[model samples]
Target: MKSLLDLLKTKGPRDAREGAESNLFTTAFASKLAQGQSAVPWEARAVEVAATRLPKSRGTRLLQSVWAQDPYMSHLSSDRVDRMQRFFAFATISPNRDLIRQDEYGSFMIVLLSGTIGVDRRQPWGEHLRLAETRPGDILGEMSLLDSGIRFSTCTTLTDCEVAVLSAEAMDEMMEHDAPLAASLVALLARKLSLRLRVVSSRLSDNPHG
Candidate 1:
């Protein structure tokens, strides 16, 4: 049987023009999601963060400490963490914002530096099913981030949130410039994803109603 990494890695731009294709994907993806498509709407109201860029040197050690404790993230050396900090864009998002909306096509994933997010699914008959709530050091939308797939659940910030966003463009650049670090990152993300899926499977198997 194919391992989970093999299954997840079977995703990427379907064409040779990596830059053009990723740009087109993001532009169209954002435009479509803006025109009234969200698991919950935040973009249509023009709440999009106007600040597009952030300095890399801010709050380094605090985030570094948190990452060092994560089982998968611990594999990254301090140098790799420096590389990651330089690569990712940091943002402070306010409460009640949707970091990810179900079924929207987006090219980035969020790493929470602080605050809480609720991950939930909207059922067919109009009820919201809470899957999990995330905290500091947690990652949101990474499955889609890795595979460029549609988001399976909506992730909404429940408090003022600080995040590091890793974009597809950044990922591609990383892969080109630092192949080993990129491989480590992909492996790290894959292991985290695989662990989550295993926990979910275990829960479902244990549930009498499931």
Candidate 2:
């Protein structure tokens, strides 16, 4: 199988790169999932391992701590926790960079391990309306993963930030093979959605004239 980097190089045009890479990765990842192997590729693992040999980043350590205490992850067994950790790939975004853009199609969710991000909605006039600022331990893109739709908001880093990303294919494979994990995930997502709705309701109530 071709490495993801190799596949990415074959895709033409800088503007199309991100989409092409995402599609290629998802297809290859889904194929591995179908074979009952871990969704993360060996090449990806090798890269992560190498990166971690240097002193681990503060964000990485923070993410490890969150996995131990966050309600969304705390219920997992040791083995499941280990497996879940492996499924994620670490990412860092520079300050002012958009982590996700509104209307972009995505098949992955992100856990904000460190720093903050601003979630903004693009108005018809192209001005951005700030919706929320996400802090560490928050999860973004769950709605997209659940519905397979375009991103609803643009998530941009307020400062340098680190995140752990879990692809939809990996999540689906985990749900298919582990009922308990699936239940936990669904419950967590439901709770997150409920919280978000409450916030929206409160905002609407305050802006009744709009």
In terms of TM-score, the best-performing candidate is 1
What C-alpha RMSD separates each model from the true structure? Answer: 5.7, 12.1
Candidate 2 worst ten-residue window by lDDT: 46-55
Which regions of candidate 1 are displaced past 4 Å? 1-55, 201-210
Displacement of residue 124 (Cα, Å) in model 1 is: 3.0
- Looking at model 1, the pairs that clash are none
List candidate 2 segments past 4 Å from native: 1-61, 67-79, 125-127, 204-209
Write the residue-wise lDDT of candidate 2 on 1-210 in tens digits. 224223333434332334434454355445545666443332353354332221234445666677667665566555555545644667665677666668766567778887899998766666657789988888887766655556778887898777777777665455444535544565666677678869856864565343
- Using lDDT, give the best candidate's number: 1
Per-model TM values vs. the true structure = 0.74, 0.64
